[model samples]
Target: MQKPHSINLSFLAFIGVLYSFQSILGAITFQGMPAVFRQSGIPPIQIGFIYLLMLPWIFKFIWAAPLETWRQKKGRRTNWLFLVVNSVAIVMLLLLTLTTPDVGLYFIFILLAIIAILSATVDTALDGFAIKESNALDKNWVNVMQIGGGYLGSIVGGSLFLLLVGRYNWKFAVYAMVVLLLMMLCYVLFQQQSVKELGQKSAKQSLQKTFASKQVQYGIFIVVIAQLGLRLAQGMTMPFFIDYGITLTQLGVIGSIGGATASLIAVFLTGLWVTKKGPGFVLISLLAVQISMYFAFYYFSEKAELTLLQASFLLLSNSACVAASFVALYNLLMRLTSPEQAGVDFSLLQGVDTAIALIAGVISGALVQYLGYQSYFLLCALASFSALVALPLLNKSSSPLKVVI
Candidate 1:
């Protein structure tokens, strides 16, 4: 893999902005619109199917191979990024600005799905660009940009967008997004691409052979095990808050102040730790924090009456740990990626992680319904603890990280 001679701040900024733009679409699809739909008297089942719009993200790896092949040409990824942002994403946002939620509900869904496809494609290309440009010493910093930018975008797309809708109108909020997207696109178009080419011999390897490696299998295991508990616990948080008597306005405030802000700080800190101590060490350490937070959550669930302060504390602290853990996990995955097929390898791992989160989310509702929040949280803690036991297995590999376990 070719390494840049120095840590380029401009490149990092570009990455951060790119990821933030992509995540805005994700935030709107997954978080922002659902609440709006529910408020607009859309049935629960109909809103539930909104998740199906995100299927593109999970299945994106299937197309990633072709994207990797196309990326063999110089500047193709950048060109593709520009094309998709303009033709699909920007156009979709513009269309959305013309219609209200009640009248254009189905139309908005279709537009969001198209935007999701565009976002997933852009993600695959950008992941490859980031992995190919940075060396082992700096991959964590790259992840800091990717994950941190995502949190910042979520705050805008999920929280600020809702605030705009509540105060102004849906069209106005979407127009603001369109303006932001265009500004980001201007940056993309002006920035010079610096990606170096990989060797054709390495690039020619079959996708099956790529997955057959023991390291890849271990990485997949790590992704699934590491994310399952986090997803399970997080999925039930809003419902738990509601059952405990937290109002919608309070939930929004807590989610904005606690979740996204905490995550951004955690992502930066986790990157530094991963850079210095290595991902293996960071992973184990963050998992310990995660497990502790899960127990704290259980204790809170048992409280006779939960206060806003307590809820904010639990949500913010857990969000920080989850963000930190994600940084560590992605750093490890980046280490495992092949320079020749970074997009394909990374996309498959991401797809698995997303799938695990989705399944865990589905299971979480049922588990909480049957067992209650306290027991469900206990199960989540146990699940995270299991990942700690599995850590040693993942550490027994040829990756650059020390076998800290």
Candidate 2:
């Protein structure tokens, strides 16, 4: 038996920075690319198909087990993988700067899919690294770091990048991202591996053990349903705003400043509530609030013309609800993980969540085309409500499995 290393801020902060850089990569594909396409008159259905490039995330679990074995033999390779993939990602960005969607749409998507593969690999490694380093108490803070860092990254990658695109041109925006990527690469190269590395073993037995449990099955359903509506609605938001006459710069300011600020506040408050009342309670409450916010957005969109201030407020509210929802659900997932099998269990859970979200995202464009925005939003509200039906599954008598680090 061995004592686990205590949690350290430097390690936690490193994870946060990694998450931020990853979000920047994601923003290039999801945020920056979509905004460009929409402005170029690409249809919503076509824009929806762009999400298909993200399919690698849904399938990363296929490699996660083997990667676990490799990790054991290699020792901590977070920096190695991070540096390699980001190096390739930077090359892709440079090539992307030369081609426009109008000129090379399919080629751009092909490159994006490749980038997604590398990014997903980095994501899998990072999640394992975070879980292996943190104990039960620190896991919540880890979740905060994950979400808060993503918000910060979204501000930089999503909003700020959009501003650069608006202010100058797409090439300039891509050039800007390349510079940021280089800075991150330098940081990753210089940073020492600060946490103790866990020995890798085949996750097959852990997989069998996890799937055999009724509680684990129930937890899987909870994560899928909990995340479904948010993913679906989020897929449609940029198009929704564009159709509503919102300018890209306005969206950038709202998202970078207002959304990021609000989400950080929400994460902090949710952290407090989770400490006081527990994750199960916080999860259900956040889901209820999420559902309400969807309806609220629907009402506002239909009933009146929204001024910039009103729109900003609505976007902030949306960001806050999303932040709270992520914190709550991840908190729940962290509790379900067994320390010995953290990699496989978390990957399987996340992979399934991404799979469900992929289905929802692919269909969301058609759903909106068929139903219109108001009805589409109501549909999201209804989908979120379905999660409440699964609440009984989480009500098992004993406490959640404690993580022994």
Candidate 3:
């Protein structure tokens, strides 16, 4: 393994932004886009249609696996990361600059999809790099660090952006993103990549092995099923809350102030528990709390007095559970991989997970339309419950992390 030059807080923060940008998009879409669409004289459903263009995120794994050796022969992840992150920022900045309802709704979405494809590529590469860089013990902390930065950005872009910036001027949203892109660009220019080659088979040979191995097939299945379950836990609750007639502003408020705050707290709390007990212990506990909170929020959704407090707590706990889970799950990914095949292995795991989410997205939309409000969340809780049961086997490896080289 080639030794990387010493890395520091700044680079970790940069990596955090790479992942954080996703949630930022989610937050902006749910909260900011509706108003922006309205202001620009665009139909609300048109926003959704435009987003449908970015659907490639659902199966980014297909292209990600080839990168296993694509960057290696060049001696660093920098080659791919450069194309991915910078391209996404540039295209998104262009989207923000050029979009108009008169531009043809489908065209907007198609362009957005292009950006999403590039961003997802960046995300897949970063996950592979993160695993290669950290060891077993530092894995959770590394994840927490990245996600913590991301959630922090989410807080600003999600919660504060709409409340303060969008209200004053929708165009400010574009300005905010531009500044963020500049900041991101500055971070990229200064960061030391210093990735030495992973002296192993080229990406092509590893891709063949990944498909040939029965063990990998089983591994992929486990990863997919668990991801499906976990995502259901989120999807079910959110739509139900929307159905209950919670305004987008209210949802954003809870998510921004309450949700963001809780996620920040959860990151620190996760660090503490992982130190005291273990990442697995911390993760399972957070999940249980989240599930219980979901039920509590359901009940509180009806009560006038407890509604705000209970809902806030539910958001907070869920954020914490997800924060802690980032560490545990990513570490699991690192443990299950091989040096000869890191990109393919991680991409397969992520692809399976995202495929489950894609199916669940369709299921969620249909469930909300056809079923009673409560049933959607009930199904989500059940998904988490199932994944919870499988935790023991999935987390069986306490294996340390390693550099692929």
**lDDT sort, best first:** 2, 1, 3
Writing each residue's lDDT as its tens digit, candidate 1 over 214-245 gives 56666787888888888777666655665676
Residue-wise lDDT of candidate 3 within 1-405, one digit each (tens)? 323444445546656766666556544543354334544555333433333433565566567667645655554455456545765656664566465534544554555556667666776666666555554225556667766866776665655655544345545656776677666665655554533322443445255676776545655655664565456554444434444445445655777777777778877666666656665555555556556755665565554343555556665666666656655555455556665556667777666766665566545555655764466566766766666676655455542211100
Candidate-wise lDDT, in order: 0.74, 0.75, 0.57
Write down the worst ten-residue block by lDDT for model 2.
396-405
Top candidate when judged by lDDT against the true structure: 2
Clash number by candidate, in order? 0, 0, 2
Q: What would you estimate as the lDDT of candidate 2?
A: 0.75
Candidate 3, position 230, lDDT: 59
Predicted structure with the largest TM-score when compared to the true one: 2
- Off-target runs (Cα >4 Å) in candidate 3 are 1-11, 22-55, 76-80, 83-85, 97-105, 135-137, 153-157, 164-166, 193-205, 212-218, 236-250, 275-281, 301-310, 393-405
Give the range where candidate 3 is weakest over 10 consecutive residues by summed lDDT.
Answer: 396-405
User: lDDT tens digits, residues 1-405, model 2?
Assistant: 334544567766777888888888887787767777888888878888888877888888678766655664555565677788778878887888768787789989988888889888888777776776666336678778887777677768887787787778888888998898788778767665554454444344245765675546656877777788788888777767767777778888888888888889998888778777777778777778878988987886684356687678778898888888877777778677666666667777888877877777778888877888898899889888887666645465443432210
Residue pairs in collision within model 1? none
